[model samples]
Target chain A: MQKRISIFIFLLVHIASINAQEAKMASIKEGSFVPLYGASSKKPTVVKSFFLDVYPVTNEDFLNFIKKNPSYSKSKIKGIFADKSYLAYWKNNFDFGSANPKSPVTSVSWFAAKKYCECQGKRLPTMEEWEYAAMADEKRIDARTKTEFNTYILSWYEKSKTYENTIGSTFKNYWGVYDLHGLVWEWTSDFNSIFLSGESRKDKNNDKNLFCGSASVNATDLMDYAAFMRYAFRGSLKANYSTRNLGFRCASTTKY
Target chain B: MKKITLAILIILSMQSCKDNTQNKNVTKEKPISDLSIYNLPSQWTNQDGKNIELKSLKGNVLVMVMIYTSCKAACPRLVADMRSIESKLKPETKKNIKLILVSIDPETDTPQRLKSFAIENKMNQEPWIFLRSTEENTREFAAVLAVNYKKITPIDFSHSNIISVFNPEGELIYQQEGLGVNNDETVNKINQEAEKIR
Candidate 1:
């Protein structure tokens, strides 16, 4: 009888642990915004979620990938492969002897970034996910304030340095993700499609190719004035164009 | 014997519990198509100085790239690269594709400026239009595309370089970054993805 009672208690405890595990697994939703940077009072645009890295695949990561899969080496890549700008600075200028293996990679094309993410059982985040993460902390205001929001954002650019380092070296956002705002511009998995005239944001169902969107604000405010400048920057790029600042990180579905 | 049987039963139940937890983990991945972009405010304009409503470009693939006419270095190269992809397509396939260039430089890229810029670039392709929205709408669009840009100076802007592509049904198909250098790969990927729609 005592053994039977002990068995019943053991079964209950095991079931409870399983229930807890299931709950943890079920939490990641499609628009799950993990807050990286906290909100600033002036520019209330809260960045709730973002990629953990600033740049794309680097030479170090790609070299290891090539070592594992020799078919993807430079010789094997056909027409319009990595250009001189892809790894120009890193290979020729920087000394990476002390770089970390798991740091965000640099000097890779969009194809190479996608391929590297795939090989690692991961994929690039969608544009929607990326923007959602960026503006997670962004807020729209009727008027602009003389505050640290714009100052801090502008300061990020001034302090911007080379691509030789990994993410998380600077201050991290609320979600524990690193290097979203200041590092290098990461790549997403969307195509370079623009929105048409008479397009309704609600009916975005028709134009599936449109990957870019932004927050709403009045044009009168000085701070809100150049919002369109942000959108056009991404639309102007071709796929293979890699610059000193362009880099990417990978995201997995949690299951993989 | 009875004691042994009870212990075995407890162990079996625990094993089954572990399997259930694993199953829950497997279901967390949602399909990409299930996601949608957030809506924009009313009263927007296209790059060609045309009023924009959401209903006009139904049942067409919308490819959007953001740029300013004043951009000397990356912007022109991006347009040329996109043109290369557009030129390669069959006319009929091209008809189904809507190429849009949204200007981030709203201060300078007025409706007239956008219109002239489109003509200068030979962007007369059907359903291809350039647009300039209010600074608010532009930001909304940027947030949706995940593209980031900030003005370093009056004429110069520091921004993320990327292109966004959507399918005929308005589902985000793929995005390619790196403009002039990645043109061939970008075009190939877009063509391959567009072919899979039907």
Candidate 2:
């Protein structure tokens, strides 16, 4: 009888251990605001309430993911979903050498980041949600007009190798989210939706005829050069492209 | 002893099922090239409501664009661009090509809608394929094609105007950007690829 009782306890513990640990998330109340893009013209866009991770995804978290989904490991991942440098920094499939485990995992492609979120039953935040949450300073929800807020972000852009820093190492925002500005650039679900200046000759013709309805889209706030940098960075990304300073976090719609 | 053996067999069968599903295409075909789009595993539905995988179109040269049936602006010219490309191709090479238009708005563009659009555009004949899948797969496919798109209103979307060509092995070979640009280069590339299959 004692042996039988012990066996039951062991089975319960084993089953619990099999499940992946859930990441902590903060609740963001739904609100409306006009971001630089995504709104109809320059009108306000309504962002429904969602939950977002407090910090960017860390190297340790991704390591746990690849353990369960071996197909996504650096050596085995399909070429269509990621480029040759998907996890160039990782020393091996299960090991991340010389890099801090708590630092945000960079050099991950959009497809790889999307898969990571899905495995956790979460998804990458839409661009509106990301921009909405990011606009906040430590005190105010919308700080685009604040000179200090814009300056701080621009300074971080000038900083080198901030991706090597640990997550949650920067100031917490009004939404209780951390490292939104000072860490690394993140991938959004709709990152490809952006259309910047018709810089290229191909795009010059495309803007007139190829993208017929895009005449309505223009920079809503040219003074907010920090936001413009983010939009331009998103515009340049292809799904399979990965860089050393690019990472992402997960978000989910909140249910009452 | 008998019960334990039976339990083990059940567990083994479940493992086999998982493996078969994951390796479904990899095992049947020669190893897919690292750069081939056929490596994608997402399932899609064609205009006829038949479910198919991208791998099924492996043997033909592919000319693909992303557009919705409801677009008021760029999609029409994009479609016209595709049609003009097809008209310019040599009659012999046309037999070995498939011009696919994947819908960015899957919610509104059903298989029936796609089929009707095909008929309305006089593209109901051979070598014209219309495909729509779940929204997630659509975004992923757009990413692969470097096609940017966004829904602006209930019935309209703004998207990049680019047409891509793929060789018979599902590797991207050439891309023609912008609207109504010269098709001579695109046509030459298509002819060259088709020549290889002949």
Q: Write the per-residue lDDT of candidate 2 for residues A117-158, one digit (tens) a residue.
A: 876668899999999999999999999999999999999999
TM-score versus the correct structure, for each prediction: 0.39, 0.90
Runs in model 1 lying further than 4 Å from the true structure: A1-59, A90-103, A136-149, A194-230, B1-198
Least accurate 10 contiguous residues by lDDT in model 1 chain A: A209-218
Question: What are the per-candidate TM-scores when only chain A is compared?
Answer: 0.57, 0.92
Instruction: Compose the digit string of candidate 1's lDDT tens values, residues A30-147.
Output: 3433212111112333223333333345556566566544434544432233444554444332333455544555656665566666665556665545555444223421112435
Model 1 has a DockQ score of 0.03
Model 2 CA deviation exceeding 4 Å by range: A1-19, A199-206, A254-256, B1-25
Query: lDDT tens string, model 2, B43-138?
Result: 899999999999899889999999999887778889999999998888877889999999999999999999999999999878899999999889
lDDT for each of the candidates? 0.53, 0.86
DockQ of each: 0.03, 0.43
Best by DockQ: 2
Q: Root-mean-square deviation of each candidate, in angstroms?
A: 16.6, 3.8
Q: Can you give the lDDT of residue A150 in candidate 1?
A: 45
